[model samples]
Target: MAPRNKEQEAEVLSWIFEVLGEKVPSGQYEDILKDGIVLCKLINKIAPGSVKKIQERGTNFQLMENVQRFQAAIKKYGVPEEEIFQTADLFERRNIPQVTLCLYCLGRITQKHPEYTGPGLGPKMADKNERTFTEEQLRAHEGELNLQMGFNKGASQSGHGGFGNSRHM
Candidate 1:
């Protein structure tokens, strides 16, 4: 590939750092990088719009299903909700790249510690038959959200919020 200009390079590096903080400790860069790629792929499957969103945001951070899911999981699992909440916050704020990373972490936790089932067993328990979040499906969701958000933005920007001017109250 051709070498990126300074601006382009800076942007990429900035995104990397934004998603992976310095305090993440040393010796984990490889795993983090690997996980990031896997997650990007998974999320591309689950919600390609999230991928476009990360791109649109001009950052590498990954957006997942949403924090509410995790919050619910914490309640169900009876684990320390604070930890999950904080993690979800990081992903929501795009401080981390990809929300699936958090889910992966949670999945591992549940596996390693049976006591930690997370907040919502329903979603987790949904059999393999229902868990087909392919990249194509995600692309559809992205398209829908994009259209909705675009319409909202346009409508709002149009001044009267989609409705024409109103006479008397």
Candidate 2:
């Protein structure tokens, strides 16, 4: 189990509730999200119908299904596989921090969807800044040394001794 951050946990909880437009339930973070109902609802809110069936009340396996479903839905919605937390992380309370991280990542991914105008969490994602150059312009720079790389100004190592040689006084 990784070390938990109360502040980060609180922020994630607040963001989730804000997005879902619900009050934070009185309970531990893991307990509140263990059943995966809230997680399912969160993904649905971000991308409607992402989770087709949310098992509201059921046995452990069935409930874990909800977490799995949430994971799949978020993956489809653009959360990277690596960033998605395992079901046990939340359901088994093995790594609550990872679960929190997954939620934060989901919140961050929301910025990618223009239709999602709901509250956002974390720093706003930077927009893509793609620069296109003409063929001539690209060719023009082929032989030129990019100043950004470094302005060597015809530097050389003529005075420097090779490796293993000591410098003279």
Off by over 4 Å in 2: 134-165
Candidate 2, 68-166: lDDT as tens digits: 999999999999999999998998888898988888899899999999999988788998999999999989978988877877788967878999998
Rate residue 86 of model 1 by lDDT. Answer: 48
Clashing pairs in 2: none
Location of the lowest summed lDDT over 10 successive residues in candidate 1: 116-125
Which 10 consecutive residues of model 2 have the lowest summed lDDT? 150-159
| TM-score, every prediction | 0.22, 0.82
Please report the candidate that would top lDDT against the real structure. 2
> Per-residue CA lDDT of candidate 1, range 102-150, in tens?
4434343444344432232112433345566778877776545566344
In Å, residue 102's CA in model 2 sits off its true spot by 1.1
CA error at residue 167 for candidate 2, angstroms: 3.5
